[model samples]
Target: MLQGKPLLGVTLVITATLLFAINDATNKYLLVSYDVPLVAAIRNIVHAILMIAILGPYQGHRLVQSTRPGLVIIRSVCLTVGTLFAGLALQLMPIAETTAIIYLSPIIVVLLARPILGESIGIVGWLAALGGFAGVVLIARPGGGLDPLGVIFALCNVGATVSYYLLTRILAKSERTLTLLFYSALIGAILFGLAMPWFWFGAMPSNFEIILFLSLGVTAGLGHFCFTAANRYAPASVLAPMTYSHLLWAGILGWLVFGQLPDSWGLAGMLVIAAAGVAVALRTRFARR
Candidate 1:
């Protein structure tokens, strides 16, 4: 059923990416004022509260009832890990470079989904996957991209994202969207709080900074909404590569908000990566029929 669903999924997925890119702007802003764990904690804490306000009284209760408790737990852990790695990489690498390297998650997801999701692969799938991988090389361009530690964390970001996608597919069969989100945030908040003791160094924030810290949760909560919604109509393997939309927007956001931009070589490389991802998505759509 190519029935416009994936097309809608693509559009909605890009919207979600833009939201995430904007959220990244807010998050990188907070990094200067806060430790990584605390930044993560504040986001989840505010998100849990915001969800309560928006959903208003246990409407998703039964939806939660429908979920497999085990998979939900896994989903939550992967999300926290992904966020942690992202924050760490953000601290270590340029925002644009980190975002580009993390685009490898789609490639990882395609590799993992076969056994994990019991999906079949064909020659075309392999070809597209290789094309996507090649695109990563172009974006990095050896003498360019990110530092070694930055590459490792970005690759770890790919690993965490793959795990998150696997968990999402596991839950796709039985859980409701609101329930998935509610439990994911609930679990993430708990784990983040627990991790605080290892890295807990901070002064209490000023009132103004406090507000941005709280947006930590708000933007993530909103981005996850768009993310989860996309998963319902399209598989992670389908939506995964499309997330490179982050790279282009990150450059713009990095410049407009942070007063930084990549050199022409980096921009040219990123354009190829983004175009490669889109081409594969379009090819997949055609191959589906």
Candidate 2:
């Protein structure tokens, strides 16, 4: 059985969160001029190619092997759908706000862990989840001036994310991390590649933009690899709150890249979310003692 390494898992998750923030910022930048599906396709295509070129030579069939094929497929589907929604939302909303709303998935994951993963979340965990939700409400509250459609897309992403994380936790026991990452990359590449013709109408990207396109896969592939690997070391509940780090990364990227920053209320919301994550981490640490 995979051994528990909570500290390592938390560190891996935090690393993944930073990588995912960079990926999301890059996607938001490209979505301005490229179709969502087209951008998503390139991201996945490069991801699959990188995986095959890097891991295939060493692992070959082992990279695709899985004990529970059905669950892996379902998880891949959730990730693919979530990517679409996240892309659409990014096109219409600021990265930080879109990410803040989507971070609600971690809270939902905490709530679902007991029933879905047979993992218990004590009272502190439950309260942390509620605090996280309240933070999202602050970020998505009325008069926030966010696009309603973008908010909707982000919320949809939350559903997909919750399912994706839960499934990741479940599959971590029997599936190798590379196998899970490969399946997700393969499914996205195939689905979006098949649909590319309909969405491929943009001008040829400049050399710099081309590099940006390729970087999507690099960042995302690494992010997912870390994310999937972390689950093998920690339960879903412990790792869920660590994902809040994405909010901080997203906010910084949005301001630095796009010159967009959340207002006071939104900043308050982010602080609440961060505080809740800290609380959860401390609670988990103390409980272990």
Clashes of each: 1, 0
Query: What is the C-alpha lDDT profile of model 2 across 181-236, one tens digit per residue?
Result: 89999999999999989987757899999999999999998998888789788875
Task: Give the best candidate by lDDT.
Answer: 2
Error of 2 at 11 (Å): 6.1
Best by TM-score: 2
lDDT of candidate 2? 0.88
**Model 1: clashing residue pairs?**
43-217
| Model 2 residue-pair collision total | 0
lDDT of 2 at 48: 97
Where does model 2 exceed 4 Å of error?
1-14, 226-242, 281-289
